[model samples]
Every structure is written in C-alpha cells, then in structure tokens.
Target: MKNSIFNTILVTLSVSLLLLLGGCAKTIVPPTDTSAMATGSDLEYPESHNTGTMGEAGFSEDNLPLEGSLDDNSHSFNDTDIMNMPEAFRREHGRSSEGFLPVYFEFDQFRLSPEMMVVIEQNAAYMQSNPAINLILEGNCDERGTAEYNLALAERRAINVKRYLTNTGIPENHIRTISYGEERPLFLGHDEKAYKYNRRVDFIAE
Candidate 1:
C-alpha cells in the first residue's frame, strides 16, 4: 500500500509539470508576420484603401468649387477675337490699334532700299516694345507685270519685310504674309506717282 501511494503521487506530479510547460511554450512563441494582424491604425500602408472612387479624395475640375467657371469668359481672352474686343481689354492684353508705317520698294523689285531699311528698323523697335503685337504684311505691286509675275513679286516683298523683322528679334510666327499683287493699287492712276505708291508693303495690326 505505501509503494502504490508513492507511485500515484509521482504520476500526478509529472502530469502537472507537463501542463505548465505547454502553457509556457504557447506564451513564448511570437507570430511570424505581425503586419498580417495589424488593425492599420499605426500601419504605414493600410490593408485596404478607397482611392476616391466616389469622390472621397479624387480631384475633378467639374466637382471643385472654383472661383471662375468655364462658361464665364469675362476674364478670358481669345487671340483671334482680339479685333472685336473693347479698347480697354485690348490695351490690357498688350495690344494696340496703332498702325505700323508702310515700307516702300522700287518698281518690280523686292529688295529693301536703304531708306526702306530705316523704316523697317523703326517698325522693329515698335514690335520689340509691344511683343504681343500681331502683324499682317500686305504686299502690293504697280500694275506693270502680268498677274502671275506681280503676285510672285509681291510675295517676295512681303517675305523680305518678314525676314528683316525676324532678324531684328521679332518672332517669325507673329508675322503673316498676304500678296495683293497689282489688284489693290494705293493710287488708281496709271502714272509714275501712282506706281511709286502702289509698290509697297503695308503693315496691319491685329
């Protein structure tokens, strides 16, 4: 009876020790990936994010309360419609109604005369000051040559003026060329005085 009692006590002690060791093992082992169980309160990147699918964070011009609306063009400007704009608005946008002085050429010649070069220089100075000015170089010729030949000459006249302006620091794109040839004469008479006035390039501001 004493031996059986001692054996039973030993068996009881072994079972209690095994149970305590199993509990300690569970408490000591840590999770492999802590991020997997994160609640995302202090996480660098959230497990799931809503990227403004229903306007939660996305930005759109249509949805924003902008100071100006697309239909409100009172503050906007169109370069092509500049001529129709009011004088005040035109001045505000760096435009002027002042005309550029015309540059005359010799009869049937597209080359710039020394005097004509002086005129072009002055024009370039004006253009430099008002860099926003758009120019239309209208080339005219005396009623001397055939329509085709005069038209070609007129184009050369306009191109020459354009080249001179561009060389003087004016942007080439700001100047446009149009050839009237001998069709639109400044002086209708068939005299040397009339021909002299007709052979010219007139600058129109837009």
Candidate 2:
C-alpha cells in the first residue's frame, strides 16, 4: 500500500514538472511573407516602389560618380531675358518665360498631382504655340536616397513630364530631358520646406 502511494506521488511530480516546462517553453513562428518583414529603414524611399532606370542600367550607389554636375547651357534665352522681351517679340517667339513654372512632386513620388498637371498643361500650350522653341525638362531630386537611386528617380520624374507634354500635342523631339538628381537643389536644408522645392522638374529653354 505504501509503494502504491509513493508511485502515485512520483507520477504526479513528473507530470507537474512536464507542465512547468511546457509553460516556460516558447513557440517560434517563422514569417510567412518575407516582403512584409521589411522595415522602414530597409528602404530609402519606403513609399516609392519604382526604382526607375537604376534597374535597367544595373547601377548601385557605390558605382556612381561622387562629384559631377549635369548642365547644358546652350539655350539662347534665359528666363529673365525671355520675360523682358517685347510683347510682339514674345508673341512671335513664345509667351513670357514666367509661364513655364517649375513642376513640383510629392516626397519620393514621380506621379503628377492634379495641380502639377495644370502647370504642365500651361507649359504644353506654350510649347504648342511656339513650335520653334525647344525646351529641356531638368529633373531634380531632394537630398535623399543614394546618388544612383536619386538619378533614376529624377529621370523618371522628367520622363513623366515629357510624356504629359507629348500627350498634350508637344513634339517629342522638341523636348529634351535631363536628370540632375540631388546635385542641384533649389533650397539647401534637410527639412520638408527645403525638400519640397528641391523635388522638382524645371522647364528651361533649349
């Protein structure tokens, strides 16, 4: 009778020990979707999915040049000079250069906003009226992301503007596109106020 009682106690103790161990154990579940595991820091522009020309060119930040400026100042008329021209001369050549405003974009976005579309429409109308005037769309980006990535993003921004202009009756050949990336900034600062100005596509006479 004593042995049976001792055996029951021992069995109870063993079961109790197993329960304690099971309570202490943790069950690890592996992530089912690897893409969902990406954190904000993993991507430079977390909101933007398009990598643009970087993928096509097979370029990385390490491979790109550190110091260089892209400029083609071969245009005959500057904004000030064009604006100061006589009314008759402008009518014969083109409208006031002030009409060609810089087109701005949202953070890390290449898609045109409704407001930006209106700006593009005005620029396109001017271009359509003055077929002799060739224009350059200078794509720029804020001081964010890798040089290669920014260049690619900027190129996409300019290409989108050009696409809109062409769709609005502006000849493709009359428009040249260039990407300055973060090399040329309208405002120099890390804040959104400055970044908003830097992220733009300027219209320049070519």
Candidate 3:
C-alpha cells in the first residue's frame, strides 16, 4: 500500500514538472510575416508616384510647359508646320526689303555686320510690336565648302542672330534656330551673286 501511494505522488510530481516547463516555454510566432512588412512602411516610391502624376518612372506631363503659354514663351513648331512654310522663305534665295528682312553675312563669317545689326534691330522692333509672334532664324551658307563645315557655320549664324534678338528684349524661348547650310540657297550658282544671297539668316514668323 505504501509503494502504491509513493507511485501516485511520483506521477503527480511528474505532471507538475511538465506544467511548469510548459509555462516557461517561449512562443513561436511564425517569424512575424516580415515579407508584408518589407512592402509596407519600408517601401520607397518615386517622386512622381508620391505626387500622383500620370507617367512612367519619374517623367510627368505636368512639368511640361503648356502650349501657347506666353508667360514662358514656350512654343514649338512641329515638322508639318515647318513643311508648310512659304517656299520663298524656305528655299528662295533673295533679300527681303520690307518685313522680316534677311540678315546677310560675309563669306564664311558668322558675325553680325553693322548692316545686319540694323536688320536685326528692325526685326526686333517688329517682334516687340507683335509679342505673340514666334520667330524662326533659318541660317544658310553658300555651297562652296563641305556640307558638314557649312552646316556648322550656318548654325553659328543662327545662334548669333538669336543672341542679338534676345538682347533686344525678345524672349529667348520665342526664337527657334535651324541651319540649312548649303542645302537651301536662294541663288543657285557658284558666283558671288549666289553666295551673297545664300549666306544669310532669314526670319520666318509663326
């Protein structure tokens, strides 16, 4: 009978030990679902995304200047509009006497001559009167040099004309420049008459 009682007490002690060990055991919480946490508070978004603008990556159309907005003078001519420009202004080689006179340059020179400066001043005056008109400075060159060299020279001529116009209170962005080089000559010949008409910057109004 004593042995039986001792066995019962031993079983009770074993049960108590098991319960104490279970109470002290650490709880395994399935690693806290770190994958969802990684995508939540720690996720980084692009600047455009944060602003809720519609565009891929960081490019947003809201940042672009509005069309016909004169405040910034941000206007651009598409290829179709350029193609529809007057043939006389596009390729005809001649001096304009009245409105938007062509600014002539010396052979292989991009500097604005005193006479050319006067022409630019007149053009600037015209632009000041019509603030909404956009201008295109088309630089040309005689067909005497390599196409590449003439193209670069023509570009310089256009830029110089643009600089002069900007100094005269015209918005810099209102003027667009293009170099025709020897591709579009008013006079199509090897003589000075042809070269004289070809080496000029023509103003096209839009």
Reference-based lDDT, each prediction: 0.59, 0.65, 0.62
Give the distance in Å from residue 28's predicted Cα in candidate 3 to where it truly belongs: 83
Question: Each prediction's TM-score against the native?
Answer: 0.53, 0.57, 0.54
Error of 3 at 43 (Å): 56
Order of all candidates by TM-score, from best down to worst?
2, 3, 1
lDDT of 2 by residue, 1-206 (tens): 99999999999999999999999987542112222111222132233543322332423222333221375553435646665766445433332245487787776666676677788898888777778888878788887666766776677778778877887889888887778888866555798877877778878775
Angstrom error of the Cα, residue 60, model 1: value is 58
Model 3 poorest 10 in a row by lDDT? 33-42
Q: lDDT of candidate 1 vs native?
A: 0.59
Worst 10 residues of 2 by lDDT: 33-42
RMSD values for the candidates in order, in angstroms, are 33.3, 15.6, 25.8
- How far residue 113's Cα lies from its native spot in candidate 3, in Å, is 0.6
Which lDDT value does model 1 have at 49?
Answer: 31
Give the candidate number with the greatest lDDT: 2
Say which prediction, candidate 1 or candidate 3, comes out ahead on TM-score: 3
Question: What is the RMSD, in Å, between candidate 3 and the native fold over all Cα?
Answer: 25.8
Ranking of all predicted structures according to lDDT, beginning with the best and ending with the worst: 2, 3, 1
> Model 1 segments beyond 4 Å from truth?
1-97
TM-score attained by model 2: 0.57
